[model samples]
Target: MDTLKQQMEYAHNITLENCRVAKPIRFTETSSAYGGGAEGLSDGFAAGFLWLDKLGLAAKYQVTHLFRQSFFGGRYALVDMQLNPNPDLFLSVLYKRLVEGPVFQVTSIDIPAQLRLYAHCVRNAYYRTSWSTEVVRFGGDKQTLAIMHLFHYRVSY
Candidate 1:
């Protein structure tokens, strides 16, 4: 309908086409756990963004940033999501329905991740989660407060 929408549509088409065209014959993983790599980002986060981009949701959600954070006045856990359209909405978040462990402050950006790929990051020592699926980690302290980034765009005539 408008310039932004048009661009989104075009980008969506390109992403889907590229995914289908490339059709990753196999899945390969480069773990940041071993040796050295990026920082705080994960292979899955990267893959997930690629897949979401292919599905056209990345643009819709404007998932510019994602990560867990201490929220509810530092009483509960939250997800600090950020987008280009509205950066403020990207405040401390706690999207997960089930929050494990106590709330805590952000100690460091990426104390344990090879590549920062999560939505929010803090040193595990400062903030811990017992939930196997609820833990937030970074490869190292090099990563930014946000986990990872997935940039997008489109041009039409």
Candidate 2:
């Protein structure tokens, strides 16, 4: 579901210093002619996860699976899924179990109500950035069962 990506991005795109909204639904900015900011952009994706983990916010959902489907430009990405908010301790352990420490691929977990989501990167690794997440209920359970799509993208400068 696109909303998963959008929600992740919304929780991620906040300015840590001021807590301001930093991402839009799409990118429309012009980049440097030669493109130098690609490194931070790349690391940001993975860093987003680690940041969320550090804050104990990443565990809100199941993240039943994650997969890397398409890679264009200089990036490769994986889509992750979660049934709903579980807990931060679980998220931290689960992420470490699936992504790091052991490494779990998206194809490894299969469940219904499943759809794909993606993260395009421009960096070499996730250890070099500062980003995080915060999850909350979608007003109520009604919102989750009713809405199937939500989208968010960031235009980096």
Candidate 3:
């Protein structure tokens, strides 16, 4: 499936059939880098958004582990040899820090068809703060009304 919706459906069906044992599912090489050189680093924002969505999907499917193939040295590496972090690296960090909560189903009437939204609760280790951040990521050059959305959802105890 070329679209995220299709990918999510595929994953959901597969998980329903094969997730009985809770066995580890390894999602490796989650980078957008294909070859080497500038092209490898060309994924930019779209890639980052896709990566974040993939993480959410993985978590929704109860994926045990998600690994990034190349952190450095590769064309799609998170940082260059000098250790300066790339744009996607920050997204990776955000995923790690904010995605500790169990995945929950969300429904939105306002979201456009082309846009995607993913939500997760704050990790307990963090402070007892309720912060809701709405991120709007424009897809492609069209700059359509539909875009990517990342929400830090909260539940008060």
Q: What local distance difference test score does each model get?
A: 0.28, 0.30, 0.60
Indicate which candidate wins on TM-score: 3
Q: How well is each residue in 1-112 modelled by candidate 3, as lDDT tens digits?
A: 1364466557667867887754556677666545653543343555665566667667766667777778887657788677887777898787688657566565656655
lDDT of 3: 0.60
Candidate 1: Cα lDDT at 92: 19
Question: Model 2, 1-157: lDDT tens per residue?
Answer: 2344456455444433345643222222211112322344432343343324322222222222322222223221111123332232344344453342211122313322332222222123465532222222212223222212232433211
Against the true structure, what is every candidate's RMSD? 19.2, 19.8, 6.0
In terms of lDDT, the best-performing candidate is 3
Candidate 2 Cα misplacement greater than 4 A, ranges: 1-37, 44-46, 49-59, 69-73, 76-94, 98-157
How do the candidates rank by lDDT, highest first? Answer: 3, 2, 1
TM-score of every candidate: 0.19, 0.20, 0.68
lDDT (C-alpha) at residue 13 in model 2: 49
Return whichever of 2 and 3 wins on TM-score: 3
TM-score of 2: 0.20
